[model samples]
Target: MDLRPARAHEAGLLTELALESKGYWDYDEAFLAACRDELTLIPADVERRRTTVAEEDGRVLGFTTLDGIPPEGALGMMFIAPGAIGRGIGRRLFEHTAAKARRLGFARLTIDADPNAEPFYRAMGAVRIGETPSGSIPGRVLPLMEYVLTPR
Candidate 1:
């Protein structure tokens, strides 16, 4: 798979990917709805953040959005096409995002992850800091974690 920064043409596909990702949290309809803004905001938000796309055979397979440089970091979004999961696309995206974070002088990378995705982040070296209520759920919550990297 080839990974590169996202371009204007991929905006619609990225929106689709974001919706598909929201579907994974079946128990939380509110969470999905709350994410509506992100789906619409990403393309425009690229002006201030790092957005990368993963492609294989000229097809978009996944994407990752970095909110800011590491240390004071955040992952605005990370989604892989349903058909492309478990093939290392997400890891490559994380590595790419992390490398950029390091270069930008971030010392820690954080993600407010979907509960189902906590394991993957753990494998990537993110230690759970705490859990916070889901944006859409009145009482449901998910893990917040961070991966600490050496200073650049």
Candidate 2:
């Protein structure tokens, strides 16, 4: 798959992909609707947050966003298309995000991951630091993880 920066006009497409990816975990409509805005990829964020897309043959397979200031930032978003999950796309996107974080001088990347994705992040070398409240669901919490960029 090819990894490249996301384009401005592709915001809607990316947002749909994120929602679909999230729904892959079997979340109900109400739950997904509640998370829509929080999962959206705004055009401005494309450049500001360093959004990246993974594609192949001109088809978007996955995407990730590296957010916040250097030396510490959030893996703001990482989603693989429902059809593309389990084919190593998520892993590739995670590695690409981490590499970009390191290049931007980030010493660590924080992740507020869905319970379903916690194991994946852990497999990618992130450790669960605690829990964080969901931006959309008031009573929901997610695994808060940290990935160190500096070499061991």
Candidate 3:
């Protein structure tokens, strides 16, 4: 798999990838529509933030985005094509985001992990800092996990 900086022309593909992971995010049809809107903006946002894509055979398979370097670099929107799940893409993305954070002098990478994704983040060395109650999402809560890379 080749990991490269995501270019601006890839938003449509990334949107598809995001929708492909609906099962993992636990987003219903209504929720997914909203999420899709956000995902579609990723390519444009990449021009302003750090966004990387993982591809193989010239096809986009996954992506990871970083926001606001640490003391706080958010590990936001790490998604792998649904067909590519369990193939180590998520791990690679996590490592990429972590390394980027370190390079930027961040001491922590945090995530508000969707419930189904909590275990994956835990396995990636993020500790459950706390739980964020359903803020905007009705009937759904998320765990706020923090991967401490250095003493705060």
- Can you give the TM-score per candidate against the true fold? 0.87, 0.97, 0.87
Candidate 2 ranges beyond 4 A from true positions: none
Task: Put down candidate 2 lDDT per residue, 1-152, tens digits, no spaces.
Answer: 89999998899999999999999999999999999999998888899989999999999999999999988899999999998899998998998889878888899999999999999999999999999999999999999999999753
Task: Give candidate 3's TM-score.
Answer: 0.87
lDDT of 3 by residue, 32-89 (tens): 7655655564456875668889999999999888888457778877888888999999
lDDT of each: 0.80, 0.93, 0.79
Writing each residue's lDDT as its tens digit, candidate 1 over 17-106 gives 878866865736665777676566445665466789898899888898888744588877898887788899999999888888888878
- Provide the lowest-lDDT 10-residue window in model 2: 143-152
Report the number of the highest-TM-score candidate.
Answer: 2
Q: Which candidate number maximizes lDDT?
A: 2
